[model samples]
Target: MEASTSERPAAAEGGVAPMVRFDRVTKRYGALTVLDDLQLDIAAGEKVAIIGPSGSGKTTVLRMLMTLERIDGGVIWVDGEPMTHMPGPGAAGSGSLVPASQRHLRQVRGKVGMVFQHFNLFPHMSALKNCMEAPVTVLGLSRKEARERGAELLSMVGLGDKLDHFPGQLSGGQQQRVAIARALAMRPKVMLFDEVTSALDPELVGEVLTVIRKLGAEHDLTMIMVTHQMGFAKEFADRVCFFYQGRIAETGAPAELFGNPENERTRQFLSAVLEAG
Candidate 1:
């Protein structure tokens, strides 16, 4: 079937087009469906947090956007352009949602950057080198320019003095900060954080969250975070989506959702989470 180009009206202030859209998107593994016809839209410069119980498929949303996992059905749009599929060779608006070619995927995927729960820094490379490698290699930036950018980002994450340190030498928070800098070096339009603070020690979580808060306050990037840090989500996100049974069961402004959730599932989930904390 030809992929539908229809999209929800721009929901941001001033009617700007959505930065990301998931239209009837589905993901399945064997007999289990991880994401079932999930539909979501994110406006440019918006901060969205995905939160739910363990099997609610919150992380899958970000993973699918990063192209780390393939969708079984439907389409995903980034910047109003087809992400999972490209326009076909012939007629206008005639393309289907076929498996995207590697070249096409690479071109579109560059618009996104993702930081994971575990610090995925190169253990052998110094923090500066780890931050510089991608910009120099994939982005084709000059070594000197990449280094400058890397140094600036590392410093922004409060790691200027640790530029020469390896991941092993740095604490969990510091290494995660380096990973954030590395992702930012690519200058992605959309940033995804998948449980970025999950692996950190209790005290260390604040440092990473502080950096993320600064980014949300200062930058115009569209940020999507999958996190269990309820307090951080309430404070940092403009909207919080509660996923249930592989679908977004409820979503609203942070205050509304956390303070007066409309969905029973959401209320129950929040109650349990709050009780656990």
Candidate 2:
């Protein structure tokens, strides 16, 4: 079930370079350590799943990548650029915090887009408008161009007919799909899904998963997801990283990790989750 190189659309194609790299990155909240010296590398167009217990820091990785949370230590590189360092005014001779300018931050941040668990759609706007707003406001796309791209994305998510529908008028599954389309409008280099289906009803979970599966199968977007859906994770993820106590316990091909786990923590966690599944 791996997608072929030829299957990638022009928009999805990219060099086989490391899109993101986390080198011994650690995050802390006050005195509490959330991520303990985590090291990870995500290649272009690769789909990776992060699985762990409730407090295992799964969402922290996504938030850090989105730059929503600053790393307490270590560095993160995006598309071969140093995100933690920026140029500052040269102190009398030479010494500065390399003032991380907001302009530089915006440039790196623009390459990543995220879909949260809650459908963070603008409730006041129609589905089409929700998707169009960012492109027009941030990317400076013309109204006509943004509308066209929004329509295409809505069609891609099977919501072309619901373009005029507000978030309140849509079902949980439909709203999630719209949120995804909105993210795609940004044409990001990396996409993050943080327990996106966790908020949906049991029956609606499959619909959102179906959209994600299709994304993995057809699109070349580099995706990093933190999900509890073991079945989908097993079948969809090219690689899976199991975390334990804020650290990566094990990482490998999904078949090897899920079918023949190596780490004891992963084995125990997989057994518990799969049994409940």
Q: Which candidate leads in lDDT? A: 1
The TM-score obtained by model 2 is 0.90
lDDT of each: 0.91, 0.86
User: Model 2: how far is 249 from its true place, Å?
Assistant: 0.7
List all candidate RMSDs to the true structure. Answer: 1.9, 7.3
TM-scores for all candidates: the values are 0.95, 0.90
Clashing pairs in 2: none
Q: Tell me the lDDT of candidate 2.
A: 0.86
Query: Per-residue error at 133 for model 1, in Å?
Result: 0.7
**Highest TM-score among the candidates is held by which one?**
1
Root mean square deviation (Cα) for candidate 1: 1.9
Evaluated at residue 151, the lDDT of candidate 2 is 96
User: Which 10 residues in a row give candidate 1 its minimum summed lDDT?
Assistant: 1-10
